[model samples]
Target chain A: MNHVSDHDADHDSVYDGLLGGDDSQWAFGTDFEDPLAGVDTTLPEGVDGAALAAYCLMLGDDALVLSHRLSEWCSNAPDLEEDIALANVALDLLGQARLLLARAAAADPSVVPVLPEGSPVPREDALAFFRDQDAFRNVRLVEGDRGDFAVTTVRLLVASTWRLALMQRLVTSRDAVLAAIAAKAVKELAYHRDHAARWVVTLGRGTEESRRRTEAALATVWPLRWELDRTHEVERTLAADGVAVDPADVAAEVDVLLDQVLAAAGLEVPDVKRTGGLGGRTGRDGVHTEALGKVLAEMQSVARAHPAGRW
Target chain B: MSAVATVRTGYADPRAVAARVTDPEMPMLTLADLGVLRDVEVEGPGRVVVTITPTYSGCPAMATMRDDLVHALTDAGWSDVEVRVRLHPAWSTDWISDEGRQALREHGISPPGAAPHRDGPVPLNLMPTRRALTCPRCASPAVEVVSEFGPTACKASYRCTACLEPFEHVKEI
Candidate 1:
């Protein structure tokens, strides 16, 4: 009477190799190790670590949401190469999101409370499991809907332009993590901006229908542009410390670049009124649209499902 | 394993190593083949610095390529490797070598045509009408674009009626 043990079973052994075996020999480790270890954790003198973390979350959330929106067009893009291009851009933003979120979690003292023995939660776990949307600090442009190609391109141009400006300044940030992330992102955003700019010109100056549709998309998105320039005391504080972009400075440069792009396409800048009445302080105050909540659910769902599952 | 003992160590020249480092996205061409690997310098005893310029400002692979450079160099036994990214001269399709073009054609990607007349009266962006792309498979000047983009960002998808084959063409920058 031979008894088959579960551990000794051949079929179960094969399944274990496929599913649970230690396969860390891959090119990059697939095991769920934190990608942010060894990152410089010191904040600039006179800077509030918690505030900086909040600020970084805003930036990270913006990239993450926008990347998610762009990725939905993976196979649905006009062409195969364009599909690859969009996916590449989305991957770039996703990389930025990962680094920025890691930094935010590392900096925020409030997010990582003292354990039983007064030790703090690991930064990786904090970013992976903790934090909600109200804790997110991303901008309206990135969180906005993915409309037509024209709308997508317009938003890309606007977001990339402003991001480039901010990243240019960020290279000199007092925070090493911010500077490192910015240094890598500036180059990525430059290409993103160029890609969007080319599309905008092509669509805006193309046939009558294309031009009209692009103009309408621009008009629809123009009102949300004001939210990008909404300044806060935290931003001012960080800007003074040379750790964050002065939202006001980015606004002026963005306006000029946008104007030049519109002029080139022989299109007028839309006159849509800013949503100033609704208050532009929503993101900084931990307030967001229904879209963000939906996005967060999708993003965190997988990680939450199998809390400690390793691949 | 004794072949490893004969291998030269300590900061193998970047120019030599870079000759082998092809663009991951454009596998048909190497960094040296693309002329994007601008310079290689040996600093101090064991430190090697390789400089590269991106074809475009916001190319996502720039970071990955930098990491690749470091990994490749370090794996080859170079103790200290540094990759410096430069953007001054900005990459152009013109930088792509004839060898690279041949490789691209062999890989079913059409190399860019000669630069159109943009210096004269015509504006740079509006000047060139799309020219008939030659079938890389058959060399017949009868290919048509299936799509503006291909499997990757740098290439476009094209199909040749003559050969009845679909191919990826490296787009003109």
Candidate 2:
């Protein structure tokens, strides 16, 4: 891959070229090489490694699950460019999830879900592909269905907006790994927020059909958003210890950003009543919707088929 | 995350040879030219650690950059080479050197202008603004964005009205 032409970075074409050149670079699977290859991952004094692991799981799960949802649009987005956009966003989240999951697995291998006897997989893959829906710790905002383009755009706008706000503060975390991930992620999340915001405004102010659909999408997606803002006990504990961010604190800024986007899009913020929500079973508490189980069935199918497979 | 932070040995960094590695996607631009090269340092005459940041979180070129750095250093006879990626003071398009920006324009990619400060309260690109992008092909401010993303993740697709040529616009992060 040289600076030969415009084709070097084409997502699919890279695989096409690599397929012909190097057997080592099969171009089929992720580069599972350790992301924190040479960095010091030691926890600060008195900061519980287990607690930090849990916090990392909470953050990692959000990114992993949302990345899966976003990737669902790969070939189905309204246009070619949009398909690329969604995939780029998904890959960014996947990259973040990869690093954080590796961190979690490093801090507490005990939390890694069990797999078959002789099956070997990276910790991040094990966490993403082996866990049951009940074992996931991502918030509900990222676990549900990826709706129509309008709904997805609105959801992306909301999800990235909230994440950006949270990441801004996380960049200053006491944990170096968490801080680095946050520092890296906030930039990517900022683009996701803005990209979605553009579509949101375009749809919100487009033809009558577009306006109606955008409003309907907002109605469906806005209620689940509250689940993301509520602080889970694990996050709350880590927040107190300066190891994690409290979701509650990010809400005010998130609200302000959401309002700004909504206003610019000429859409009213929905007053959708929060459903049973994260009540007895919040996502951080390992509670997720049935949709997640179905999603995992599909996402993990290939790995489950050949447990020891290395692509 | 590896429990042990092992720095690979048998590498060299004479003249900062790795800094000359070009971005794999945009071959015309070196990583140093793009401001992706943050620092190159030698430790005790035995170790050379090169710190580089990715232009985007998902930029595919990062892996290529790292591998290129290691290979280049190994060829230069350094005993130990360490490449550390520091995410703090995150990489921004604003960091592109003046020379790099000039290189981008000369190579047919419009260099990004100043973006909203990360320190600013508002997140970037949320508001709709249709600033006429200056065209690299014709040096005209009459270019219109055709797509938010381009052939590469770091750029966007646009066409210049003056030259009527489609080109890449380096997105302001």
Candidate 3:
């Protein structure tokens, strides 16, 4: 039943010479095009590059961390349909993360870790893999483990709603690259939000057990929603400069959207205290939950081990 | 070079050759048919540049598309070929050509409808995508969604209630 060719019997591994045997081609493939190849990446006039870079990292890390979590649900989802759906959502977010991280590196190269010479690690890869836990800027909401299906669904619903709102306005960003990124992301986020919202309703209105678990999951995740809208100083600067959407500005909007989804699901927003970080510090300040360490450790293990090893 | 020399030099039209490059994921459609191939410019006798846009931010097919364009143009006699990606004016399903639509239907895949027109904020609708689509198999309008996500990022899985056959629909973004 093995239909695969055995022409390469001399090769120890089946994939030994995959993609022309170039090890570098194994990871991203040879002649990999830069995601932002022809896009203009210059900073807006009088805008602080460092702050923009930081802002990009904040958004990029959010997508990257949450994407990793979602991808973990690859085969573990409740059904085959749900499994493919989650993976698709993860892929969309991962794409957004790559572009944002690449933009961050373009805005300020200093933020990119100095990898070994001839490492062949792209700028975005270096930022994603080389950064320590203390350097990630994602909100604590997205860094946690892949909770139960209900938990994941609720978190996704909230996260996508917030992100969709932000991206809608980001289409007008002064920075063309960010604007372009947001324009495309807005559509994808809308789909992600729709998918999550539907699941939330299904879980809420399903059996009594499903409803109970959905309620419990909401309570578990509702606390982390606070950090999502809490704008960082970098975001404020970029927003003032018309280079970013102020997270605070979108707070009321996100709340209304979430309320609508919950209402349609015949569920109420869970009453929970806001999750607080060390006095005045939070994920935006690189103050993440302990869970982020585990997430990064798993994500960075392979790339860290082979800093210069292609593929 | 003289006009006769130019024709004899194996200098094929860069745009024409680049336009024939099909998408790696959806082989039924060319980059031109998918509207991903934005523009092509002949810099000199042997140098050419091709510009393309991604269907999605994280579309894995983009890398393949770029590679395919280079290969196609190179094989067509362009020695120095550069593929550049443009992000502005993001690619829309509306850009899929009429020919592309026919090709999809011929291959038992439903073509995308017009993209959602967003005048302001994109509204949150939990209902399934409301589109007028028929089963590519039996031409039956009765079909139900199997899943919003499909084997590829650009498609959605659905089954025809009439023919009882499964098919993929290119989702409108």
Candidate 4:
């Protein structure tokens, strides 16, 4: 992705068109730098900036990739309002990804410090140039696959519930940035969970045909739950420091919610069966499905093609 | 009277001026009515800084609102304006003031009463059940959710049996 200088005059025109008139020109930045720059970062004492950054990247990448998948359903949704709703949800997740990734980049010592005097690089540039999948920290649920609306809703229910739990815990993090982001994200994730749960129940109880599909979708996505609860050394450290939620603590809550949802829909929860155990936590390790590559390619395509083109 | 004093303009206070900006999602409520416009400071000459936070981090309407705010203030002749987005002590449904709540009730949308039982860390033993919604129109607690998702992401469709009317209930986040 090419970086555009804040000084370009044409940038203003295009932005105005997108935003409608010159009314909001003040809300955006002319500096063309990452928005997270130089805002008094306070990391927990003794925590490793690089590791923290990598951890954040894991979560951010999960949101980014899943958001991309959700966007594919934009105009193709079953109804017009639903199309708008899905797109809105996707954009919400995208906004979360942008903030998380920008925070990760800011936390990295290797990346230039985001200070008033320092040149802060745009998040797009950092995302484009930074580490690959091996360094990502997202769980398998977000990166696995986007099957159908049923599958997506199942995944969304589980992921959003778990994230809401995590975000609730994160609101009290010793690390201010994490806490602030969590504070902002908790309500949004709550809505997300409710939205997904509604769909899961609707489809599960709607018709025999729909119920079968919903159950199958739940079964297909169940295995990924293991990845969601797995914790690594960095996670453990952060958990100890109150900067991250213990994935284990959230597992029970997530299960109870899922079980209730499934029961309400009259679908039986399938017994857990392990598969493809060799990836060693694919998401946290940055060893993702080919789906991620395809997603990144499309996401970065426009910015890459335009380079520094205005708007 | 002198020609310079020919016209007398009514001057409205800043609070009254700021109250004219409404929430994009909840058209029935203004920013002041919703407690979103936390602070408005007129500093320096014609420069105004409005501090606002989003109801949620990814609310799509925020971008539109920031534009609306600038337009409202600028068109009112406060051109050197700055809009600051703050995320700390993040927005809560609790922030909706009593006035805002009353406005919502008057607008035929039920306001959030208390935090939902599903909002806690531990799952409630109760079955996933819908609570009795209070009718915004009649203040009668005989409402049922007709649909889980409503007209917008923040609302749920409801039918008030007492009033024999269909209305939207602002879902508690």
Best by lDDT: 3
Arranged by TM-score with the best first, the candidates are: 3, 2, 4, 1
Task: Give residue B168's lDDT in candidate 4 (0 to 100).
Answer: 79
lDDT (tens digit, per residue) of candidate 4 on A236-292: 888887777778888887888888888877888878684444556556776666666
Candidate 4, lDDT over the whole model: 0.69
Q: Place model 1 in a CAPRI quality band.
A: incorrect
Candidate 2 vs 4: which has more lDDT: 2
**Candidate number with greatest TM-score:** 3
lDDT of 1 by residue, A171-204 (tens): 7788877887776676467657767877788888
For residues B1-173, what per-residue lDDT tens digits would candidate 3 score against the true structure? 79655753788878888989888878989999999999998777688889998898888888878777777777788888888889988889999999999999999999998888888877878788777899999999999998889998898999999999999999998
In candidate 3, stretches whose alpha carbon ends up further than 4 angstroms from where it belongs are A1-28, B1-8
Let me know the TM-score candidate 4 reaches against the reference structure.
Answer: 0.77
Q: Distance from true position, residue A300, model 4, in Å?
A: 2.9
Per-residue lDDT over A86-167 for candidate 2, one digit per residue giving the tens place of the 0 to 100 score: 9888888888888898889888788887776766677778888887788788887787889889888888888889888888
Error of 4 at A3 (Å): 29
Q: Output candidate 1 Cα RMSD.
A: 7.4
The residue-by-residue lDDT of candidate 4 on B13-111, one tens digit each, is 455567788887787788876667878876655667777776655565666666777678777766576767666767667777788888888887888
Instruction: Single out the weakest 10-residue window by summed lDDT for candidate 4 chain A.
Output: A112-121
Instruction: Determine which window of 10 residues in candidate 1 chain B has minimal summed lDDT.
Output: B119-128
How accurate locally is residue A160 in candidate 2, as Cα lDDT from 0 to 100? 88
Q: Candidate 4 chain B: minimum summed lDDT over ten consecutive residues — where?
A: B3-12
